[model samples]
Structures are given as C-alpha cells and as structure tokens.
Target: MTTVQLEHPHAQRRRTLVRGLPLAPAVVLMLVFLLGPILYCLYSAFTDMALTGSSETSFVGFENFRKIFTSDEFGRALGYTLFFTIVSAIIGQNVLGMFLALTMRAGGPVARAVVSAVVIGAWVLPEVVAGYLWLAFLGEDGPLNQILGFLHLPTQDWLFSLPILAVSLANIWRGTAFSMLVYSAALSEVPREIEEAATMDGAGTIRRLVSVTIPMVRRTIATNLMLITLQTLSVFGLIWTMTRGGPSGASTTLPLFAYQQAFQLSQLGYGTALALVLLALGGVFSLIYLRILRLEDGVR
Candidate 1:
C-alpha cells in the first residue's frame, strides 16, 4: 500500500516534468538568442552610439525617430520602400506566380520543364552575380539597347532612367520562383473532383479560377504575400549592388538608407534606430500573416 501511494505521486511528478520538456530548448534558445539581442538592440537604438570615440555618447530617446521623420531623405526612402514592396513583392511576385502556377497546371511536360528551369535558375543564382547580370543587361550599352538599336527603336538608359523599375524587375526575377512553388504546392492540395465539378457547370477558365481556384488558394496567397513583403523589406545587397540608391535618392529604400547612414556616414545609433523601424515593419507584416494563418487553421 505504501509502494502504491509512493508510485502514484512519483508518476504524477514524472508526468508533470515530462510535459514541460518540449518547451525547455525553445525557451532557452529564445532567451539566449532572440529576446536578448532584440532587447539589447532596442536599448542601443536610443543611445548616440558611434563607430569612433570621437563623439560623446548619451541617451537621445525619440530624437532619432524625430530626425528621421524630419529628414527629406528618410521620408523619400520610406515612400520608395513602400512602393517597391507593393510593386515587386505583392503585385509582381504574387500575381505572376499565380499566372505561372495556372499555366503550369494546364501546360504540357515540356512547357513545365522549361518554365521551371528558367525560374529555378533565377532563384538559385547568387545575389551579387544576379545583380551584375542585371547591371550588364540594363546598362546604357547593354544587350537590351543593342537589340533596340537593331530594331531601329530608340532606347533609354534602363538603370539610369528607371532605377526603381530595374530593381523591381530584378526582385521579381529572383523571387517569383518562391511564390510559384508555394502556389503550386497549394494548388496540388485542391481537390481535382471539385475542379471538374466547376467545369461541368459550364464555367470557363476565368470563371472557374475566380470562383473556385482563387478562393481555395486565398490562404496560400496571403501567407506568401506576407513572407515576400518581409523578405523584400530588408533586401539590401541586390538593390545596393544594382542601384546604390541611384542617381539621386530615387531608389533609396530603408535598407539602403540605413546602410548609407550607419557605414557611409558613420551614424551608428541613427542607423540602428532605422534598423529597429525595419524590424517593426517586418513585425507588422508577420502579425498580419500570423492572424491569417490562424484564421485559416480555424476554418480548416
């Protein structure tokens, strides 16, 4: 009777401890890495930290953000960042990805192979290499102009004339594959029987897509949009190597602005604050996606 009683309490203790084991590693890792660094950075952002000891350090509070808001450069960069994110990440990647997925679904093996190869090639290329390749293609005397010359059509400088467009195109080229893969996987889960039922109802391609496919894939679309928006928000290497924030501040998005301030101008604290702002932007998108994902889970 004593043994039984002891075993019951011991078993209860074991069960309680066992239930918490799964959380241990994740909690430890977050404390050591994620939460710690974020808190440190948040504190650093309000200070006048510098690369050199030339300047006196002090707490500046909201002065950094105020400086950013008042600066035309910061305003322009914010506007440009929003524009690029919407155009390249949202419209270009998401829309084109859906189109590609639809095409591949209805296309022959050969077409699918060719299209997939083209997209995967762009996806797999090194960013610097991709940037230079785009540079060569968009330069004043590049092949695009050469082709236009042969066609007896006047050609403008692609990079110089349309820096934002050039970077947007590059981003689309590099990122469309991710969205395609996502949509394709989502498309696969859509029941074939349902699709056929829609077709039997005399629904044309557009009607079927709007009424059936799109509705089914809406969750995937939202998830992909959120991911790409966050990813594109912090894109620095590709755009920097391509435009370097351009002929003026034309293509100076937040990342470029941060880089220019931190490294180029040696305003480490200001740059860190800018980085924090970018982090906040990413957090905003993440929250939206997380809510969407949760809503989808509930629906499912």
Candidate 2:
C-alpha cells in the first residue's frame, strides 16, 4: 500500500504562479498601451487641456462636457453622424449585401464566382484608395455626370451639393463586401431540408426566407448589425478623404468633429470629451443590441 503526500501550500501557490507566468508580458502590454492612454484621455476630458492656447492645465470638472452639449456644431455633427451611419452602413450595406448574398446563393457556380470576385475585390482595396476612386467618380465632371451628359440629362456637382450623401454612398460601396461575406457564410449554414419542407407546405420564397431562413440566422443578423454600427461610428479616413466633412460641415460626423476640435482647433480636452461621448454612444448601441438579442433568445 502506498500513501499520498500532500504538496505544501507554498509549493502549490508557486506552481499556480508559474502557470500564469506566460501571460505576464501580455498583461503589462495591455496596461501600458491600451489602459494607460484610455485612463489619460478620461482624466484629460475633465481638464482644460489644449494643444497650444494655454500651457497651464486645470481641472474644469464637466465644463467641457457642458460646453459641448450647448454648442450648435456638436449637435449638427451628432445629427449628421447618425444620418450617415443609418443611410450608409445600416441600410445600404445591410440591404445590398443581404440581397447579393441571397442572389449568389441561388445562382450557378459561374455566377457565384463572378459575383464574389467583383464584390470582394472592392473590400480588398485599401480604404484611402477606395475613397479616391469614389472621389473621382463623384467629382464635378466624373463618370456619373458624363453618363448623365451622354443621356442628355442635366448634371450638377453631386459632391458639392450633397457632401454627406456622397461620402455615405462611397462608404456603402466600399464596405458592403463585409456584410455580403458574412451573410453568405450564414446562408450556407441554413438547412436545405428546412427550406424544402417550407416550400412543400405551400410557402413562397419570401415567406420561407422571412420565417425560416431569417429566424434561423437571426443571431448572425444581430451580430452583423452591431459590428457594422460600431465600424460606421468610427469611420474617419473614408469621409475625410472624400469630403473632409466639408461643404460647410454637411458631413461632419462625431469622429470628424472630434478630430477638427482636437487637432485643428487645438482643444484637446473638449475633443477627448467628445470622443468619450462617441464611446458612450457605441456602448449604448451595444447594450440595445444585446438586450434585443437576449429578449429574442428568451422568446425562442
């Protein structure tokens, strides 16, 4: 017979520490790189920090936040931001991508390959490159006006007249591929027999999609919306490259507003405060999505 010897408490504690040793570098990196800047920004948001105006910094304590809410520019920026996000990412990308995915799913092999190539090709291009491409396309004498001219239709400067719409459309064209790919993968996972059964039960294609396919993939839809919404909130390069949030602030979204305030106006404190508000907006949206998803899951 053999008796087991218990390890000492100190030895066990040392072994546990050894097991977690590999994670130390990553933890330290996160603390310095990620958490550090975030904490600094939060602290600065309550102060009177600037890039140039005054070297002295003081704790203003919500003065910056108060000024931002009372400012007309912030209100306009917030409105335009919501409008662009809804029109471009939420509506345009989601609808077009879903349609493309469904169409390709029902198409022949050749059609699928060609469609995938065309759609994904846009996504592969760098953001700035895509921005320039659309910039030219929407310019005063761009392809769109050229086509209108050829058709004997009057053409005006689209970008100058509607800067926000131009950038939103450009974003939609550039970013739709992500939604398409996601929906394509989700669509493939849907059971063929389930669709067939619905069809045999005298259901139309639309009915089957609404009732069966969509319900089955509701989780993917929620996740996709949440991701796209967050991405749209932070879209800066595309809008900046296209419109520069110009035509008299017609397209100045939160990111643009924040950049203009921080860098251009040299109000780093207020800018960081606005940036925090943007972060909070994202959090609110995430909470809404999570709550909706939870409710739906409970119902299911």
lDDT against the true structure, per candidate, is: 0.90, 0.92
In model 2, which regions exceed 4 Å deviation? Answer: 1-16
Q: Write the per-residue lDDT of candidate 1 for residues 1-300, one digit (tens) a residue.
A: 334454678888998799899999999999989899788779878988887768788999988888988999888898989989989999999999989998999999999999999998998998988899899998899999999999999998988888998999999999999999999999999998998999999999899999998999898888898989998998888998898998787888999999899888888889889989889988998898889889888988
TM of each candidate vs. truth: 0.89, 0.93
lDDT of 2 by residue, 1-300 (tens): 645659898997898799899999999999999899789989999998999965799999999999999999999999998998899988999999999999997899999899889888988998889889998998889999999999999898888998888999988998899999999999999989999999999999999989998888888888899999999999999989888899899989999999999999999999999999999899998998898899997997
Model 1 clashing residue pairs (backbone): none
**Model 1 CA deviation exceeding 4 Å by range:** 1-33, 54-56, 291-300
- Residue 35's lDDT within candidate 2 is 91
